[model samples]
Target: MIEHTVKAFDADIGQLRGLISQMGGLAEDAIAQAMLALQRVDRDHADRVRADDKAIDAIEAEVERLAVRIIALRAPMANDLREVVAALKIAGVVERIGDYAKNIAKRVPLIESEQRIEPVSTLPAMARMASEMVRDALDAFAARDADAAVRVCESDSALDDFYDSIFRTLVTYMVENPKTISQVAHLLFVAKNLERIGDHATNVAEMVYFAATGTQMAERERSARSL
Candidate 1:
């Protein structure tokens, strides 16, 4: 009977993992498509991204439901309990990431209205970096790879640096040509959204580390916290 219970517990854990992975895929696609829409100033594409966020939101709800059910039924202990909680937490973070992508897509028409657009050069690069981190962080979580999680934490600094660089450039553009300040400011918000996505990905990595090792990721996790 004990062996049967252990097997059932493992199956529940697998279900939790599968749900998170499916949600991760939706979030990943949303980020990628939203950035593409922003880069091209395509409102149609942006609208699709906005619509897709609802699907991701639905998946998050399911992840939470499965995670909660597992906790009640399996009575998971120690590392197992950590893994279940991490799934819940990561689902929330991924849902917020989808929100950011939706926000970015909503900014599309504003960017499209510019008569003489300055290429939102830095925004795409930042989005790409953030999107990659999101993907890799989810992969680490699925694999329960503490080392990969630490690497994701380490990688956030680069995303921050990209944000800084773009911010400086936009400030200079606004100062030099006061007339474009409005558009430039909007671009800054987009950059900020991308930066926050990177932060959330780092949070996932931290959770992954803790779930896998049954210990805090320690000072190393804090190294990129401010970023």
Candidate 2:
């Protein structure tokens, strides 16, 4: 009976991991597609990205239910309990990441600039880096890889750098072309959303590290930004 119970608990954990993986894939796709919509100025694509956020939210609710059930039934302790709790928190974080992508999508129609702005060209690369961090953080969680989680944390700094550069460029552009301030302001929000996504990814990585090692990751120094 003890052996059977152990197997059942293992199966439950496996199922939980599977759900997280599925949710992560959707979140990653949302970021990529939202950026594509921004780059192409496609309202249809942007609308689809916004609509897809519901799917991520649904999965998060499901994860919460499953996690609660596991705690009630399995009475998981130590590492197992940590893993389950981390999944719950990570689900919420990933859902927020999806929301950030949706926020970016919502801004597509607001930007009406016909001329290609310099800052607009740089946003996609920043979005890609943010998306990659999300992917890696999820991978770390799935593998229970502390080193991979640390790498994800390290990548956050680069994303911050990208945001800083984009912020500076947008401010300069707005100063030079006073007529484009409104449109450029929308791009600034989009950049901020991507930066927040990176921060969310780092949050997930920290959770994963704690779940894997049962110890909190040490804080790393970040460059000070005036903005």
Candidate 3:
């Protein structure tokens, strides 16, 4: 009976991890599709991205249910408890990331410009970096890899640099082309969304590191110092 209980508990944890993986994949795809829609100024594609956010949100709800069940029934302790709690927190973060992507997608139709501005061209790279961080953070969580999580945290700096450059360029463009300010402002919000996605990804990495090592990530302290 004890052996059977142990196996069941492990299976429950496995299922939770699987759900997180699925949710992460959907969130990552949302970011990618949002960027693609932005790049092409495709309102239809952007609408699809916005619609897809519901799927991610549904999975997050499922994860929450499963995680609560595991904690209540198995009464997980130590590493197991940390892992369950991390899943709950990470699911919330991933869902927020999906919302950020949806926010970016919603801006697509609002942006009115005859041609893609110079700053608009630079956003895709930033989005790509943010998406990669989300992917790597999930991978780290799955593998219980604290080092990999730390690496994910480190990558956020580059994403920040991308946002900074795009922000400067957009401000300069707005100053030079006063008429385009309305359109360019949407792009600024898009850049800000991507930057927030990066931050959420880093938050997931921090939770993963804590789950894997039972300690908060040192990078978080360093980041606080810098701020």
Candidate 4:
């Protein structure tokens, strides 16, 4: 009876992980579609990305349900509890990332009215970096690999670098061409959204590290910090 109960508990954790993976995929799709809409000025694509965020939101609700059920039924101890909580927290973070993508898409119309600028290249490149961080962060969570999670944390700095460059470029343009200020402001918001997505991905990575190792990554990295 005990063995069977343990197996069932394992199954519940597996289901939770599976749901997170699905949510991660949907979040990644939203980012891609939002960026594509930005790059090409496609309203249809932006609308689709905005609509698709609902799916991720729904999956987040399911994750919360499973985590609560497992806690009440399994009475999971220590590591098991960590995983259930991690799934719940990660789901929330993923949903927020999806929201950021929707916000990015929402700005597409304003971008459409603006004249083309050469530095528009920077925004898409920033989106690509943010998307990759989201993908790898979720992959690390699925694998429960603390090393992979640490890598994701490291990648956040690079994404920030990308965001900084885009910010500087956009501000320079806004200063030089007062007429484009409205559109530049929209693009700035879009860049902020992508930067925020990367942040959420990093948050997920930290949760994954704790779920897998029972250690907060921040403490570990601080111990290894260079002067």
Candidate 5:
């Protein structure tokens, strides 16, 4: 009976991890599709991303329900508890990432059929970095490697730098070409959303680190408790 119970417990945890992985993959796709939609000015692709948000929302609800049930019944300890807690943290980040996807989707209609600004370089780079961060963070969680998690978390710096550069460049565009301010402003929001997505991925990496090491490696995660 104890053996069966242990199997059941492991199964439940596996299910939760599976849900996290599913949501993470969806978020990655949403961001990638959103970027493609932007590059191609494809309204249909943007609509697809907006539609996928509902599915991501459903996954989050399921993840939370399972996590809560496991906590209530199994009362996992040590590594198990850390894993569940990390799963919960990741669920929230994945949902926020979906939200960013939706935000970018909203801009598709506004920008489609309009003339794009020159040097649309940094946004794509930022999206690629953010997407990779999400994937790497999930990988670190699955592997339970604190060092890998730390590396993933540290990667956000490049995304932030790219975001800031885009911001400055866009502001300059708006100032120089006052007539393009409206369009440039929309792109600014997209860049900001992508940057926020990176932040969420970093948060997941930190959670994974805590789960693996039981000690906070980043000041941002540690300072989070005081708040």
Candidate 6:
């Protein structure tokens, strides 16, 4: 009976990990499609991405249910408890990442055909950075590497700077070319979506830090803020 219980617990963790990977793949594809839609002004691709968002949302709900069940039924302790807790938090970030992708898809149609603003120069790079961060955070969780997760959190500052730079450039475009206001505004929202995606990655990294080391990076952030 003890052996059976151990096996079942392990199996639950494995299943949760598999679900995390599947959701990650879906998110990656959604971001890719969003970028393609932007660059090519492909409304069809954007629409498809938007349509697929429901599946990601459903998966998130399912993961949450499973995680809750594992906690209640198995009464996981120690590392098992940490793993289940991390799963719940990571699932929320994954869901938000999907929402960001949907936001990008929604923006594609608004700016489909217009004189592209210079603010766009920063967006692709930001999207790439965010996607990379998400992938790295997942890898960190898989390996339970606290250091790698810290790196992901530290990397978020660069993305923040990128977002600020784009914001300034977009405002400049709107000020200089009132005619391009609508197009530049849409670009701003797209950039915001990408920035939010970076935030989601940072959230994942934070969860990983806690899961692996039982330490909250927020303490450091709070100290810095107080200072």
TM-score of each: 0.93, 0.95, 0.96, 0.94, 0.93, 0.93
All predictions: root-mean-square deviation over Cα? 2.2, 2.8, 1.4, 2.2, 2.1, 1.8
- lDDT tens per residue, model 5, 1-227: 98987999999988998999899999999999998888777889899899989999999999999999999999899989999989987998899999998899889788643566774556788899999999999988888889988898778888899899899999998899887877788899999999998898888988998999888886665678889
Q: What is the lDDT of residue 111 in candidate 1?
A: 66
lDDT of each: 0.87, 0.93, 0.93, 0.89, 0.88, 0.86
lDDT of 2 by residue, 90-192 (tens): 9999999999999999999998567877678899999999999999999999999999999999989899999999999999999999988998999999999
For model 2, name the residue pairs that clash.
Answer: none
**Relative to the unseen true structure, what is the C-alpha lDDT of residue 137 in candidate 3, on a scale of 0 to 100?**
99
Q: Residues 30-83, candidate 3, lDDT per residue (tens digit)?
A: 998998988888999999999999999999999999999999999999999999
> In model 3, where do residues sit more than 4 Å from their true spots?
222-227
Record all residue pairs in model 3 with backbone atoms less than 3 Å apart, i.e. clashing: none
Cα displacement (angstroms), candidate 1, residue 121, comes to 2.3
lDDT of 5: 0.88
Pairs of residues at least 3 apart in sequence or in different chains that clash in candidate 4: none
Task: Return the clash pairs for model 5, or none.
Answer: none
Q: Report the Cα lDDT for residue 44, model 3.
A: 95
Between prediction 3 and prediction 6, the one with superior TM-score is 3
User: Could you tell me the lDDT of residue 20 within candidate 4?
Assistant: 94
Give lDDT: candidate 3, residue 199: 92
Where is the poorest 10-residue window by lDDT in model 2? 218-227
lDDT of 6 at 166: 89
Q: Write the per-residue lDDT of candidate 4 for residues 114-149, one digit (tens) a residue.
A: 478556678888888898898898899888899999
* Residue 179 lDDT, candidate 6, scale 0-100: 87
